[model samples]
Target chain A: MSSASPFHGLSAFPATPANIDGRVDTEALGRLLERLCEAGVASIGLLGSTGIYAYLTREERLRAVKAAVECVAGRIPLIVGAGALRTDHAVGLARDAEAAGADALLLAPVSYTPLTQEEAYEHFLAVAKATKLPVCIYNNPGTTHFTFSRELLQRLSDIETIRAVKMPLPVDGDLPGELAALREKTDLAIGYSGDWGAADALLSGADAWYSVVGGLLPRTTLGLAKAAMAGDVDGARRLDKLFAPLWQTFKAFGSIRVVYMLLEHLSLARAELPRPLLPLKSADRQRVLEIVEPLIALEGGRKS
Target chain B: MSSASPFHGLSAFPATPANIDGRVDTEALGRLLERLCEAGVASIGLLGSTGIYAYLTREERLRAVKAAVECVAGRIPLIVGAGALRTDHAVGLARDAEAAGADALLLAPVSYTPLTQEEAYEHFLAVAKATKLPVCIYNNPGTTHFTFSRELLQRLSDIETIRAVKMPLPVDGDLPGELAALREKTDLAIGYSGDWGAADALLSGADAWYSVVGGLLPRTTLGLAKAAMAGDVDGARRLDKLFAPLWQTFKAFGSIRVVYMLLEHLSLARAELPRPLLPLKSADRQRVLEIVEPLIALEGGRKS
Candidate 1:
């Protein structure tokens, strides 16, 4: 897979369910993945940032990804996240992900920076070289705290198998200008990210949205994607209006936990998240339900 | 181990050495631990924040603690860091660390927070219930991006196993005056973190110092500790002067990467840090060396 090898469209990073003892709720996670895949998820990006991969050990992560890959059975792209804070470990993850039948690797650069571009390039090159599978650069400086400069992205694009970028829009900066400039400079396939920033990113020309929101509301994502794909900008606006309130109400609890709550509300899985990260608070949960209730009800109404 | 356990004096978070391929530089690491023990390190804290525990997988972290425990041969108290964004995993690490011969644990309550005191208290309580070993509640908001407020600390103090606190000087607020008042309400073991705030904390009635600086420049830390312990403020001040300029250099590359670099400079074994984090640059190395030149040379002037 090269830069143009089309893994870009809509992707969802489904949450990994775990028992209270911290054992992977493998059965529940598999069900969640199957639901998304059955609902026509374009790609199942296992162990992505939103998957809480950082909190899970490498072995657990490998196990989850392998299970997802086996369950999905190559129906959609299985893009395993291969971003570790260290080069050797990231390479190790990439190598294992490849062995486990991951279709592509979404690699984030060394997050703790003031990383020299050379060091960042070397990290990607090492991970890219370690695996024969395609690698997409996931540049979400907002979380990873590091961004790949267009020049660095272009340098990475030089590798034959390097493909795609999942760029999260920086909160304080303008995304459209940056994406336009970045798109102009590199042949790297670009996708947008952040639930709150998705519509703006779509309007600005990113080929897909890294839909964390999609994992919670697959049909909403599909409806929005259809509207955006057909250049039906007004219809896209309507979907955004319906779904965007979620980004605000749940913003208090954080994207992951809020999404996890939404999943619980949707009856997809148990509400238990790993501790250090608790499930939504009762007061917050009540507020979240107030917001999530209507959007879910709207979906119910649409389906009817 | 209950929260009421008495803790006193210094505890050292020893570093793990690694080979070039990022495998355990076990021989080097073993030697370093033995050297630290021989130097009268009161407690051996492995895989704590200072030990880059976050950068290691569960297996790797377990292996490291086991290696350190074996090398030290029970010569010192063996405390392991068992904190992650996931609480259950933190408990698992605690149980494993104890099984591997750790005397205690240092727990950091982190990962996606807005966590109420009730949730944090429950988190600690759950970990306390899971492991047999006494746990040191790590309070470093600087890294975790969440502070354990005094009221929360007071609530945590009620727990039987939260015997100690690794107080990182607050990032914004003044060093724990009200918290110190709150501290008076409980008999918790109080230790000053060695993260550049040691001098002030020692003055503020904190017991002992767990210094990464000690891991690098033992001469400086030993001298500083001795002076501070003796109430010889001027003697501690002299050593503090030598350590001051070297402080911000590592902040440029992050504390862990800098720790590895300092290990390299000390001619102790060091290797690549784990992913999302990158290795230090040549310029960073050069600058780090330049900043610590006087301090590195201080060993030569030591009467020992």
Candidate 2:
């Protein structure tokens, strides 16, 4: 099932550190990207949900992409998220990412007015035509609220540059069955993104683990990803157990909130999430500290 | 059940016509506002979902507001939609609308990373505090994806300027029960926005009918609203029947899509919905024309 696509294996999604005023803190972002490169994840998913791509201005997003390209320096493939509410805006973002040296573009049907299947298909086609960079269909319904029907996916797959799909974990919890169904419909490379389900997704032969936790603790997460991808069931489960506590916190408070706290705790970045997304309260922060203390040892596996 | 709140009665939500590149077509927008004024809608709901507030940029939104203020010329109370994905952006919109002479503000908890109840509360509180204008909670889950629990509504009602709520129709269809429950919690003037349910919502003694059809055919919609408000069941039902076919189109295709087509068909504006939202196909356009033909005569009761 191995393929040459960059949307394979573990793709680490790092939080973009930015000031309260929405200015990108590129130096801190570079430190995070540099760690992912040294740790040798398959790809870097920059400006993802955890990266607050929706909250940042276009200027800030461009600045972040420019900085990420310089920091990675082709050490790893960089997949930049280019989602916006309007199609033209998204096309502009796709072009900017391509010109700024993004290896691929991850696009979500980010909607305010919920789109019809035809509208979503047309949007993907427009962005796909905008750049030569391969595009991954970002099917994140939890945030974007636009579900991609298989028919729509099949139609989009016909577009030359739509190379992959990043799917949310299936509600039925049958990763193998969902993967089989999706494979029958389209030739696009398939991956799954809920962090707690990463081991199972990989174990069940998903092409990639679009991971949020891997963004902060790249070395530890990559170890788990490798074990599962290699079908070392016991090894993968053992590492999954180490992450069980963090996953509980992630489930309780969203992964975006937990990841920012982790970045600040590790002193990799002292970034504030854009307002409206407040930092965890003191009691919850203390709880996170307690849960993460034992797992700190696992984060020390960087190549440097 | 009635007060002097501008959120009450038939508050017509007109489309803000904009060019394909997201520029506000101020002259076209002024034409729409002027009609709403001549027809004497209770309040003008500018930059609503129909108005494409979520699609327009800040400068464009402010420009739309300035043009609306000049065109409306204080003939009717003006309630402007001030929704944005980020809280700071929403605050800026609210301030801009206030400075540009809006009579009230409609804020929805528009989200990218779905918000916690507390986060939504704080977001609304910040915007409410930022402006002196009265605020209407825009509880539009179909677009914003943030549903308000009654507890959240109760908490928000405690804010002085938070004077009203524009609710979607309840799933149970028991507008009376829902209204009673909401009324028990707060004094916020409660209105409903799903157009097909407008007759029942007003007939149920709800404070307002936030009508989309009213945006274009103000006299006809206002007649229906007046009948329902005055307890003339026969008159309201008769008027509601005239709109039955149009409501069907709204249900089949969204009200936003249908309304944009109507605006262009009527020669009011040659606006294009910002991209990703394509114009209705020819068959759908023909279907709309046939449905609206009998209804055209009903659009002729303007004051001037």
Candidate 3:
């Protein structure tokens, strides 16, 4: 059943950055992809919320997707972010990404306003119609503010091209029962985001994962995913303990900004972010590097 | 102090609907525009969240703005919605709206992702820079799940074209306080959306009012605004009471659908929304008519 799914395993949402002039640093992104692919990442998620896409122009985003697709060169599955607040634009990007050779799309639910479940269902349907590739629905109420409900999920599954979901634990409502209910839904793999919850969601039957903190410290998460898959509960528990302290950093203002800062701290991406997203302060940056340096080293040492 | 500011006043988010066949019903919309103009609406908000903009294509939205501009015919200020999720797309729409002779723009912050203040600010600056018109910033967190903090608002106001703010009262948050702080900091007119908090915001020193519910009961809302402006607290309170039951209708799901239904019921405009936002059900249809008929009669009797 899993063999047929477009995304079968761990996916890294590669943090994208710009040069001093604010243009996407394609070369740096290429190096990061090379490292990620060499380290055996199954899929690469560029142009995500972590990728600072909201700041880039449509043309810049299109160029970035093409660049990533060229660099990844089919070494691993590449998922592009093609969602906008409007259906036409979202569908347009979906079609563009397909033509650009993305293996799949990490589509966000409708934004800018609270969407009715029916509208959300239709949004998914429109994107699915736009492209032939697999579509991974992103459900992050912590940011998008609209939760693609289970009813939306069930309805979306009926559409043949929707292949997976990115369920970051909604900060507001209860999703424990929601995740439990997801187990009986379909063959579609559910991926966890926000590393603190990854191990738990895996235990709750999630199949794949989207990691921001994982990029900053990969092996700790990779180990946890491996342990969970192998049913090694103790190993998973230890990794979870290691990740628990680092998770607190994401709870502040501009979580995505923080995610990019963490990535930059590890020399994985550029230090700059697009306008409106303030860069981390020198003191805060130094502190983050100090706190997470050991774990990043752990990931570095584990790399083959 | 206020005279020096380029933006400071009331505004109405005009609903744009087609006929049953999806063609822009200009005659109907013209009448609605005339009615709003007659009501002394400070600026006309075209293609906003209430306008069912997400359902319209780029071509359709541009045409809608063009049509609204022609209909209004310089009778009042035309503030178009340039709030697309992507930077270039939104800037493109902003340019088109400006070219169409729109008086101002109402831009929602970055969509889909809870953009960093810098990203949201940049999105605003890019749109503001795209056109020379005064820009009214729209901060509705209920739909976007992202609030532009007062600090962020200050940053946004730095752009010369960013002249105002249209903040809808957020769901489950202190809107009155938020609006008050924003009002104190900038010379921008702070209009209350959803109208539930309009009276309070006015009492708290808000300069203007905006609402979908008020569009449904313009007489009552206008009466309240007039009364509040005249310091007629008792009279203002009276109109607020009258619109309460009617306000309950727009508070639910398909409120945008219901707005079109009422506009049709009153013969104000056509009863069509763009695709993806379907018409209401048969049973709900009956309930809506039954619920608002008396208020319409009561308001109509007052007019005659």
Candidate 4:
């Protein structure tokens, strides 16, 4: 069931920064990517959920992808998010990503109207047709409100260009069993993204761990992934324990918002969430800091 | 809370037809709007949910708006959908809508990450600042996966440029109670989408009836809305019963897909849905045609 895919190891969903006028802050993003590469992050995902892909205009999104790709300078596998409600736009974005030198395209079934699994399939198929770049299905039902069942994923895996999937943790909380079942069903490279159970998922033979924490804390997150990959469950569990409080805050607030605050607190990226989404409230920010400050201190102050 | 807003009566959420290559079929759209105007639809909404605004590029969307406005020629109130996940993009679209001579802007708080009430407030406020055209909030929880509570609506109504809201049918299916409660809370004009409950929602004193059916079957839908507006409950009920089967099919499939089929069935618009969304399956299409054929016959032969 398992097969080698281009996407493996830590695929950091880097948080996108913006200027006060709502333009993508390419300089800041470039610096952020440079830091991630320096800290040993192997792969970088641009315009991901944490990148506020949904919140940027198509032009802004393209700029972010191009800037990230150029700044990374082939140092890492640059996967660009090309998710859109319409297949045409998704295809257009996929072409844009490929032309901008992205190594792969990450897609999600995002809709204002509920879509069936058949719709999701046609979407990825159309996007895959637009570019030769490998496509990674992003299945985050929490935000998408449309879940791709195992059967649908199995069918999608048959599409030649769809080489991987960044999946959400199951709702029923059966992490190991569900992961095992999906692994058994398909040869698509399986990665898990809902940051909370990442350590466990990676330890259970998941090919990649798409990390929100990796965007800002790449060194530490890379350490955790290394431990899990090495089958050092104790080391991975210890890391998860250390990050438990931060993960709790992420659950309470969103990962993007939390990451923005942490980046600002740590003086990494200029902390701003694209509008229609404000930053965490004062009390919530205080709470997050109480959980995050000690861990940042413990990580020896290396921050992107 | 009904006030004399710019939007009133049967507001048609016209489906946008496109060529197989996915470019907006402006000539076809122009012809459709001409037919709609002739059918006595006093208000035309371009790029509403039925129009597949989410599936279009910014340039494409602007072109659609311009084409609709030119075809409408100030004969009816032309409302354009300006919803986007980013406030900046939403603002840009609103400005474009105003520049293209749309009478008002219909917006939905679309997000990949769910937004808080405070965030939705800032989103609308920023858009309002961009243009003088009146803004109508589109609250469709089914697609957006984010529902606006009554409390949030009350707060939103205070924004000066926020003039109306196009609401979804309530979750509990209590149309009258929800309409009554919303009317009590704010003076902002209220309209309803969700094709299944249009008749009842209009009868309950909703200021506007935003209709997918109205775009194609304008004469008949206008009759239903008129019956409800004129306090002819019996007439409205009769129309609802006739349309019940179609609504049922719409619920099972989406209104956009069903309406595309309906428009194509009657030879009105090109019956195509954008990518990722295929046209209905054969069995479902059969079910819809059975429900729609009789009603189409009853409408006295005015086909677009």
Candidate 5:
């Protein structure tokens, strides 16, 4: 795990601010990317699950990638998510991201029909082979619903361009043990999402924190990431405690909803979550405000 | 439920045959629907799960609806699946189905974010309000991953256009009890999918069998459906026994995979299952063939 590797540190996943009609607000998105770059996170995970990649159109996704590529300007690695329900569509998305100048690809087996492991393998193979960019296997079953077996992960690790995996937090909360098992099996750089688990994951020697909050509060999230990565247990726990309230809100109402509300409250963007995904109710939003306001103040009082 | 309701009796869902690019082969699709019409199924579920509704684009889906409406020519009610991950997208799809001449809409709370029951309610309400066509709530947790609470179903049933529900077979397998409980709560016609359980579901007094096998072997499935719905316990069991081997294949391999293989073997269409959904392996296909060939013969052999 090197600093230069996009998979090695705090990889900030920003929501692709889009309208109710699913049109990407490229300017708003560019502002979010700029914040990530300034904060000097390891990478920008654009169009990830938190970014609503599943909800946006390919044309809109391409536009977001192009804007991100321009806005980041080689300051940060832009890992674009290229997940789609159809493998061919994912392949096309990967190619689009590559052609539009993404530094790497993140592909989840975004499935409607539940996929067999072999099908997931073939899907990843097809997409990785379609682009020269390195690919990270997105093993988030919460949204995709396709769980990868260890054997399947080992098989996927053999793909030349597949260099990393973004895994969900293990159910039993055994990061160190899970990391040891995964490390023994495959040489792919391993990272974890589930923002609340970041301190433990990094402290346990995981390579990266794929952070949703990092997208909005990059500097504060980076502070926590650095402390954990440097083996500063006390410092990391202190920062982690600061995030506890926000984490509770994330658990209570999905992290995506919390992040979106924070983005709006910080006045970074006024984007709507694509519908069926509603904004937090007024009461919920007020609760989130109360929880995050102090954290935002500690986060240098919001850039905007 | 009246016989005139598309929710009543056997609703035969058919695969929407398409090229590798997801360009719906409307002519091929028409051929599949024509068979369902000639079989005199109670309704033609043109874009149900087996139809690959989630895989197709809105334009392709609308083309499929137009083709089915023309081909079926009102002989059987045409039920179009108007489900999308986004609520606005679903509303658009519902409007498309209505404008393209679909008789009824099947709305699944197709989710990428796991939806709250209230979110699911709002999604259904928006789509139902968007179209004049009667709507059937598609409660398929297998693909959608959003389970509807009984209360949410009751709430959706109160919406004027929301006329029915297509439920997954209960986990406890107590169809009689589940159906009786649901009947107590709402006037909405209740149906069940899961082809292997269709006999028991219909026999247990479910208003409809949203059958996947009914998509391919309409006559054979109709035989089982008719016997079961008519309260012929012995006759239904006898027909169901004939289907036991086929049902075993469906359970072993997903019904979609088996249905596509059966379609090709019957020479109805040379359509491919969209990528990420690979064709069954040769040995598996051979096994499927061995299981279904006899059933096809019982279906009076292939039409084309």
Candidate 6:
């Protein structure tokens, strides 16, 4: 059952494109999904952190999910992020995802209150009860401030619809050891985010790379994941080194801001980020360009 | 003008009690407000962190605010928490709060995407634009995971509607220095939360105590604040010492859970906590009881 999650391999979390007035730009989203599918990425995630789900109203988020499902058109599995601070709202979002034809639901335990493990487990259970779609627990302490303990994760695995887990980079930076420990405890399929640590997690046999970089550089990111998955350690390392500059920009700043900057740099998306979240500063954007421009030239051109 | 903000005093953030089915216990909420007003607390902050605003749906939060306004009956100033992930929704919440007759609004920069200072400013500005009520910036990095910098706070002070700020405990733990510096830069009236640090902050010329304990222990907590505000340093210290044990329990278990437990122990409200956040564990509750029992006795008896 651990190996049975449909969300294995490199999954691209495409940034949600919004118009000047902040409406979801479904036409642009469709184009982005087409590029990802054409690049042979394993799955596509809509409304993840990269998609700015938190900054969109419920109606807008539901609209984006519908558009993503329509655009992906079943070329590959479409995983939709369905997290909210309230359990009832999360359940509502899950049902919406299912109704919109999403293949699976990824949830983060987002809270304004510091959640106890018991509460987080209850949140997942309630949402799972509401939707038949397979659920993937997205553990991102940096953003959500709730780290799902291994024992709790193992407990949650008993829920029939809880099929996978997306882990943050281990706090001690011990990706290999932590992944090994998680694998030992539960049959839950485990993936990892944090673009800086994707190479390490993929090389360490993690099931998926829930990626920000994959959204922009699908072919390149897919190559790296495929190399690591196939045990081509040298190829994976080479790709890691090649992408090091971009990773440095991400680490120095934040992945969300950097990814949005990169998308804007490539002219793939508008520079608009949701309000109360400014775009990367001009100096940081220039620095990122210095890192990415050479790679863009070397790779011939961006897909756009 | 900043010093003239109406939020200067002991403001109790009463927890929003819910029924077995998770509906807001309006009768309990009204009784709690009546108790606080009777005890002569300076203000009432409804739908705050203690109110578990994040766990509530938009409609539920609006309902709670409306009920609180009706209960308070304009007996004292009421500041309602109006925060959301999206600026539009936050503005909507702000409008609802205003329509409900709230005197002011307290907002935390609650975001899934880590916001730049500029983004946070834009968020506040948008909400301020939408409502006539004075806005108090809520800086609880522990929960909201976004801190309002002194520089940004000073900048936001230029917005006429942005009148006050609810600061978290300073990271460096320099209460006097940080508060003085914030005062020097921003004319915004600065208040502080974190019940453990209330004594230091109130004694250091901060204008308000946005208190949790006050909600359940109004007379005793207000006595401490009044003492500090009146420059009775010794009296403030004595109260802080007396409350130290309960504060420690709050730090270890989380204020939300501990406050709910204390409220339950006193029979001030039902023991129900919003889902995904359980009440204090029994052992921790016992430890809290060990610390609080003496104080409860000295207070003569709880309102129950």
Best by DockQ: 5
Q: Per-residue CA lDDT of candidate 1, range B204-281, in tens?
A: 667767777666666556777777767778887887777887777655566677777777666667565654455666
Q: Flag regions of model 5 displaced more than 4 Å.
A: A1-3, B1-3
Model 5 chain A is weakest, by summed lDDT over 10 consecutive residues, at A1-10
In the predicted model 4, the residue pairs found to clash are A112-B143, B1-B183
Off by over 4 Å in 4: A1-6, A57-63, A70-74, A302-304, B1-5, B302-304
Off by over 4 Å in 2: A1-4, A301-304, B1-4, B301-304
TM value for model 3 = 0.80
Q: After superposition, how far is residue B64 of candidate 6 from its true place, in Å?
A: 2.9
Single-chain TM-score of chain A, each candidate: 0.91, 0.97, 0.89, 0.95, 0.98, 0.95
In model 1, the runs with Cα more than 4 Å from the true position are: A1-7, A21-41, A56-75, A99-101, A109-119, A141-154, A282-287, A297-304, B1-9, B20-27, B57-60, B66-75, B110-119, B176-187, B258-297, B300-304
Score residue A218 of candidate 4 by CA lDDT.
81
- Ten-residue stretch with the least lDDT total in model 2 chain B: B295-304
Kindly indicate the candidate among 2 and 3 with the higher lDDT: 2
lDDT by residue (B3-119, candidate 2, tens digit) is 246888999999988889999899999888888878878988999999999999999999999998888745788899999988889999999998988889999999998899999
Fnat for each model = 0.49, 0.89, 0.45, 0.91, 0.94, 0.77
In what order do the candidates fall by lDDT, top score first? 2, 5, 6, 4, 1, 3
What is the per-residue lDDT of model 6 for residues A49-139, given as tens digits with 9 covering 90 to 100? 8888766767988898888888775588888898887777788899998898888999999877788888899999999999888988988
**Residue-level lDDT tens digits of model 3 in A1-304:** 0123446556777677775445787887787777777766667787888786655656778888888888876577888888676576677788888888888888886455466788788878878987788888888776576766677788787789887888876564344575667756854677878777777767665778787754545556677777876777898898888766567666554456566776555556665765445666788666666766667777764232
| DockQ sort, best first | 5, 2, 4, 6, 1, 3
User: Which candidate number has the best lDDT?
Assistant: 2
Cα displacement (angstroms), candidate 6, residue B170, comes to 3.1
The global C-alpha lDDT for each of the candidates, from Candidate 1 onward, is 0.72, 0.91, 0.70, 0.83, 0.90, 0.83
